[model samples]
Target: MANPYQPIEAQILKTIDETPTIRTFVLKPEQDVPFLAGQFVELTVPGHGEAPFTPSSSHFERETIEVTIMKVGRATTALFGLKAGDSVGIRGPYGQRYPLESFEGKDIYLVGGGVGLAPLRSLFLSLVHEIDKYRRVFLRYGARTPEEIVYKYLIPQWEKLKKVDIDLSVDVGDKSWVRKVGVVTCLMDDIPCDETSSIAVVCGPPVMMKFVTFKLVDAGFKPENIYLSMETNMSCGLGQCGHCRLGPYFTCKDGPVLTWEQIKDIPEPFV
Candidate 1:
């Protein structure tokens, strides 16, 4: 069996600047690394070390994986210094994936904030690929400011798709911005999906996820139908490390994708 700990080399094909602190790296791994939507990978910047990140690209496109990273700390900072043609190590398509099968024939509501939109992008693209299987798709996203919104170029294309609706908001807007100004949960006020039959997926900062979870529950969505992407401090991609334990579950093993029903009783689940 192949060693799960060993990382395969992937060459950076291109990089796109998303924000001052965030950039998207397009990488071509030496071998195909197929991953389901919401699964994460450990990216190694050689001598610096590896950090966990979920691919921002569609899972259907395995030839090249796009990872959107924010420059937060050591490993990410090191990754930023490298450019196209550079090589990095990639390990895993780890953790649980979003349950796409259950979403068929149902309205799909995706709520994301800031960089949390990254993983949701993967799910969104997958849904778009198989658009006919689902009912309607709704994307409601929010960023701290207009400048921090990722995938600025793709939103228009997504909006043009049939049965796909998008709502955008910014905490604070600039003169050039014309979208709604408020928290992401504000968009929940008039959700068009049937609360009883739709599935809601959320990914964002812990605080944002907390409030969104409350809003969805208050809006009458079942806990089991509300999925949360809890990509917290995962160390070893396997369950061996206790770094990402949340009550009885390991975020790295049992999930990075967990239903609200599974974690509602856990203390500070969003944290």
Candidate 2:
């Protein structure tokens, strides 16, 4: 058994400036770290402190992992200062993962917004590993501004996969932007998949998830078939702390990824 509280040593391999506010850290862990798609790890910046982050890398690769970060507060700000060769503490590959088994014969719709794409990217990479097992894949991404988009470098590769279609949009346009412009729900407009044979995964801000959920439902997705990644309020990777409470559930242990049916009754602000 591994100690949940003790962090393993991980060295930063490189850092990518995904956007002005977001950065992706590639690390070489001291030991093999195996985690499924949609799960997250606790990253400790030495004396600065530790915080939770989803590995943006493919789960198929255990020796290396990628964690994308946004400079929001103290912990992240400290994380931003570190560069390649810097040492950081790491623990866990915690929480529930997406139900790939259930998605085997189903079409997949991945909707990501801003940094929320981090976990979705992990899931996407995992799915692509066994692409022939599933039917089709539709990836729709939305950002506040084209400048805020992450993973632009991987777009071409993801689009090249067989039976996969990728589209990008922004809520607002800039002089340099020429793609579709609107909310993420706007991408959900045409209702691409057969609701009964498809599953939808969404990750983003609370408001974005809410509206996206509504859109998915209106587009014929069953409440049980839509999954949401609520990687928020996670102060403790273990379930001991109640910091990530969402009504009666713990976002850290019980979720980080939950179906709409599981969270629909959790009251307001939780969609």
- Candidate 2's residue-wise lDDT over 1-271, tens digit each? 8667899899999999999999999999999778899788999998888899989888998889999988998899999999999999998878898889999978999999999999889999999899988988899999999889999888988888898988899999999887889989888778677986689999888888999989888888988899998856787789888898887788789888989888888768453
Q: Candidate 1 — what's its lDDT?
A: 0.93
Local distance difference test scores for all models: 0.93, 0.88
Model 1 spans with C-alpha error above 4 angstroms: none
Q: Candidate 2 lDDT (Cα, whole model)?
A: 0.88
Cα TM-score of candidate 1 = 0.98
Maximum-TM-score candidate? 1
Clashes of each: 0, 0
Q: Which regions of candidate 2 fall more than 4 Å away from where they truly are?
A: none
lDDT of 1 by residue, 116-142 (tens): 999899999999999999999999999
Best candidate, lDDT: 1
